[model samples]
Target: MKVSIIMGAYNTAPTLPVSIESILQQTYKDWELIICDDCSKDNTYEVALSYAKNYSNIRVIRNEKNSRLAYSLNHCLQYAQGEYVARMDADDFCLPDRLAKQVAFLDTHPEFAVVGGGVMLFDGKVVKKTIFNPEEPKKEFLARGVPFFHPTIMMRKSVYDILEGYWVSDRTKRGQDYDMWFRFYAKGFRGYNLQEPLLRYHDSLSDYAKKSSWDMTWGATKTIWLGFRVCKMPLRFYPWVLKPIVSWLLPKKLIYIIHNKKHNGKEN
Candidate 1:
């Protein structure tokens, strides 16, 4: 089956080539890369265009305005022509066998609409730790962590048609994948995760800088509340809506400390 890998590019010009090169090295050849640049100020568009020129299977598109990830990815969906659609972030690196492995799993397990693998969190110089995803996401997973590593996911294209892509809104600005997962499970779609890490996610030591932003935290709170309503979850679970606010109140250093302890500088 053909696979269409859709990625939304922001101002990640310096790291874009490494991400694309990793895809080019994939053992699975029946795939296309569709990159949508969301009005980046840097040479991100030019760099994507350069790849498109060299590889016929790679296509590039640019948005006039800086639409966020959900809108940009929806734009990529318009040009996708594969039976499967995979997600890729502009700054992450995938293992050469990622696509091939995911494709093989999905081909045999037709019951699942989506499949993802664990992720090896990478700093600039070395891998920090590997995060293992659960083999199957539970119903309560919506109130907990992400059901799947967004970048390591490969999905049947039909899932997009059923969900109508991601819910584009203010809440989704920071947690689009969370909103999507909520709706996916609500609609009775199933997903699975491989036991091993398939991608190197670029999460620098300074990731706390991104997490400390109150604006993003508030957005996550709104998304969680929205998810509870969408999934028709119980009233008790509604209390979990305050989880983000509680997390936001913690000191940034404490947040990193808690993370390190949970993962223990090794596989989690």
Candidate 2:
């Protein structure tokens, strides 16, 4: 089956080549890469266009204005023509066999609408690896936090069709992936994360701070509330909805410590 990789590129010119190369070197050859540049001030559009020019399977699209990630993702989705839709980020790169393994899993298990894998978080050096639950992810799991990495996910094209693409709203600007997962769970769609780490997530302490900001906190809170309503979750799960707000209030250093503890001290 052919896989369509939808990547949103902003001002990631420094890492864009490596990111695109990772897809080009994938073990799975039957794939198309649709990279949509979000009107970056840098040369991101030029870099993406260069790749598209060299490869027939790769295409580059650009937003006239500086739309955010969700808008760029939806733009790429419009031109995707494959059985499965995979997501990529300009700052991250995947293992050569990542797509092969995910496509195989989805082909064998039709019940699962989405499949993602573990990720190795890195800065200048390898930080730590995060392994997701191998079993089907549940609504209870999502109540605590996102169970899968957004960029490492490969989902069925039908799943996107059913969900009608992402919620392109200002509310979801900072937490689009979180909102999308809740919608999937509410709709009774199941997902799984492979045990093996297949992607390299580039992040830093500053990035974590942005993730725990007021806007992200509010977005997560709103998404959880919507999930509860749509999925008919019990009131007991309401407490979990406060987690984002609580996390937002915590100091960035404390959050980093908690994150390090979760990943077990910066080792693969």
Candidate 3:
């Protein structure tokens, strides 16, 4: 399948090369890399241009004015010319077989519009944890707010064109991916999560505090609120009940342990 990989960047020079190299090493070669810069003050545009000049399949675009992440992604979309659209971030790396595996899964299961594989969180060099939600129907996935990581997802261009692309939400300035997935689920679309780790998600230590506490909270709240609304569940369940349990009763480390054990058992 021909795929258009879109990557939006803003001062991500430090990790941009790694992200690009990961794509270059992909087992699937029938793909185009679209990298667009959101008026970054750094040399992001220059780096992108250099790659574009070197690679025929790599296309680069830059905004004259700052447009942030959402707008930058839209800019990349305008240049996309593929049967499928895949999202990639400038700071994350995909496994060599990521595209091939996701494409194969989607081809075999034509009923599912979106397909994503497992993701491994990293702190630069060390692997911290893995995330994988069991494959389920659209309703269950949406109700649980268990999204297949955006970076690991491969979606048909038809899905985006049908959904009219990402939701430009005021609260989702940084959480647009989640918002989009929620909308897809609301529309009775199906999604799947492959069990093998196919992306190296960088949970860099430098931005942990802000990303986890502020950005993630804003995104998660938006997601859960929409899920509850769509599923007709009482909103109180999140804050009054589940939030407390997730925050205190269930520690993250413990959850990680349980998840790892389950995954290991499956492998055995």
Candidate 4:
């Protein structure tokens, strides 16, 4: 199966090498990498261009101006020629077998629209956390938003065509992954999580854990309300009640510990 990887990069030169190396070392060979630069102020575009020159499968493009991430991603989608499209973040690294396994799953199960694996979170050094979601029916995704990590996703291009790609909502800029997932769910598509950590996501200590809490509070609340209530799912208050409390009470380290234990079946 031919898979296309879409990565939207900003100023990620520090960790971009790791991300590129992950794809270069992938066990699957029939894949292409499409990285779109959103006019990064750093040498990100040059680095990507350098890699593209060396690897036939890697292609790099730069935006005319400093558009946001969603616009950059939509730009990348236009260049994809693969049957399946995979999403990646500039600073995140994929496991060597990530593409091979997801491709096998999709080839075997043609009915499923998208497959994503568990995500491992790191602060550039140690493993800080993990995230997972089981194979969920369409209704659950529609009601609660995305059931899997966005970067770990592999979806058929046909699915994108059917869904008309991502919604260009202001919500998308604030929190677009969930918005797109909900729309896909509403279209009667199903989601599956591989139950293994196939990608490592990098997050800054202050930005991901602390600053984003206050910054995204209003947006996250609005997303949940629209996803759960407006979508009309028979719901519980636990997820709504616990997310903010846990975000406030627990340190990022503790959350990672719990996530690792739950997903790996052992403490890290």
Q: Who wins the lDDT comparison?
A: 1
Q: Report lDDT (Cα) of residue 16, candidate 4.
A: 90
Q: How far is candidate 1 from the true structure (C-alpha RMSD, Å)?
A: 1.9
- TM-score for each of the candidates: 0.95, 0.94, 0.83, 0.83
Model 2, 1-268: lDDT tens digits are 3899999999999999999999999998999999999999999999889998999999999999988999999999999999999999999988999999999999999989999887877774675655555456677776767767899999999899899888888678777888888788878899988878888888678778668667777877887888778877888888888987888888988887787667421234
The lowest-lDDT stretch of 10 consecutive residues in candidate 3 is 240-249
Better of 1 and 4 by TM-score: 1
| Location of the lowest summed lDDT over 10 successive residues in candidate 1 | 259-268
- Candidate 1 on 7-74: residue-level lDDT in tens? 99999899999999999999999999999999999999999999999999999998889989999999
Query: lDDT by residue for model 4 over 1-268, one digit each (tens)?
Result: 3899999999988889889999999999999999999999999999999999999989999899987777888888998999999999988989999999999999999889999987777877787777666655455543333577789999999998887776665445546677676567667777777878999887555444533454455555566667665446566642662453445566776765554455422222
Separate clash counts for every candidate: 0, 0, 0, 1
Residue 202's lDDT within candidate 4 is 76
Q: For candidate 3, what is the TM-score?
A: 0.83
- CA lDDT, every prediction? 0.89, 0.85, 0.75, 0.77
The whole-model C-alpha lDDT of candidate 2 against the native structure comes to: 0.85
Give lDDT tens digits, candidate 3, residues 2-25.
Answer: 899999999988889889999999
Candidate 2, run of 10 with poorest lDDT: 259-268
